[model samples]
Target: MNKAVFLDRDGVINEVLTDRVKFVNRSDQMYFFPGVAEAIRLFNQTFDYVFVVTNQGGVGLGFMKEAQLQAIHSDMITSLQKEGALIQEVVYCPHKPKSGCTCRKPNSKLIEDLARKYDVDVKSSYMVGDTDTDIIAGKKAGTKTVFIGKSDPLADAVYPDLLQAAHWIVDDAT
Candidate 1:
């Protein structure tokens, strides 16, 4: 079985605007946080698989169409590729928060599905995210968890940002 790293899209890989439009309503709104590509590149080097697991509820809420969301992801991936980062896949839940979807974070279905598809060893994988929901999903999926920003008891590790978290994960694996 393969070991992998699961990353959250917004706030972890890219910036999330809290003051302005919270969602990346347009591709132009997509902005990579400093060192994110480099961090992901490190993950690419260390993990058998690197994936993006996100919740884009804005699509179901009509803030943006599914095509618009795809465009944003495409732009994000293209930008990361320029920096030598390769993401194996991007799994997202495109449902409203109240929709009771099993694919959303806090459910672990997204990570579980990816693990099944890739034959990943969930216990050997790491899920990195900035929110409690992300930590919850990772824990439920039985992977070691890294929480970016703020401290969380549920996470196996915590860091100020993705770059630092990436470093710790790589170091701990060795």
Candidate 2:
């Protein structure tokens, strides 16, 4: 079985932006956080597979189309590839919170499905993200989870950003 790195997209790879009028729904508006690519590269060296697990409810709400989300992801992938980082795959739940979807974070369906499909050993994998939901999903999947923003009492570890989180993992390897 292969070890994996399950990452959250927004606030992990890119900085999260909030606006009162609308959610972030455009590729043109997406901005990657600093050092994210290098950190991914480092994680890649230590993990058998690097996957992205994200919850994108905008699609369910009709705020953004799947094509638009793909475009945004494509742009992000292009940027990461330019920096010599290769992500294995990206899995996302496009259902709204009210949908009560099993794939949403804090639920194990997405990660569990990926594990079954890819022969993943969740016990040895790591989940990195910036939200409580991400951490919760990671825990449910039986992987070690790292929280990246706002201190949480239940978090295994906390970091200011993804880059620092990567540094912590790298330091642990040494």
Candidate 3:
């Protein structure tokens, strides 16, 4: 079985508003966090697969078009590729938060589905994100969790940012 790394797109791979009141509606709204591509490059080297699991309610809310989302993802993927990182897959829940979607974070459906589809070992894999919902999903999906934030949260490990988390993951994988 392969060991994979599931990453949260917003805040983990890109910058987001600190208030969490906004969403990416266009490619211009997306900005790769410093060292993000490099960190993903490290992840690509260490893990069998790197997946981006994200919640993108902007589309369902009519705030963003599906084409805009795809463009943003394309830009992100292309940028990462330029830095020697390749994301194996990008899975997102485009339904509104009130839609009762089973694929959203805090729900393990997306993570579970991907793990099964890819034949990945949950115990050896990890879910790395910047929110409690991400940690919860990882735990429910039976994977080790890494939180990117200041306080020591519910995750198995915590770091101030994804780059630091990447270092920890590399060390752990070794």
**Candidate 2 positional error at 68, Å:** 1.3
lDDT of each residue in 50-89, candidate 3, tens digit only? 9999999888988888888888888888878988989988
Weakest lDDT window of 10 consecutive positions for candidate 2: 15-24
The per-residue C-alpha lDDT of model 1 at residue 29 equals 79
Show the colliding residue pairs in model 3: none
TM-score of each: 0.96, 0.92, 0.94
Best of the two (2, 3) by TM-score: 3
Clashes of each: 0, 0, 0
Instruction: For model 2, name the residue pairs that clash.
Output: none
> Tens digits of per-residue lDDT for model 1 on 28-139?
7787778898898898888899999999999989898898888888888887898899888888999999899889888999999999999999998999999999999999
Top model by TM-score, which number?
Answer: 1
Model 3's lDDT to the true fold? 0.88
Candidate 1 local Cα displacement, residue 106, angstroms? 0.7
Candidate 1 or 2, higher TM-score?
Answer: 1
For 1-174, candidate 2 gives per-residue lDDT tens digits of 887788999878876665522355887677777888889999888877888899999999898899988888888788798999888788899998768889999897888888888899998887888888999999999988889887976667898888888878766644
How does model 2 fare in lDDT?
Answer: 0.84
Candidate 2 ranges beyond 4 A from true positions: 18-22
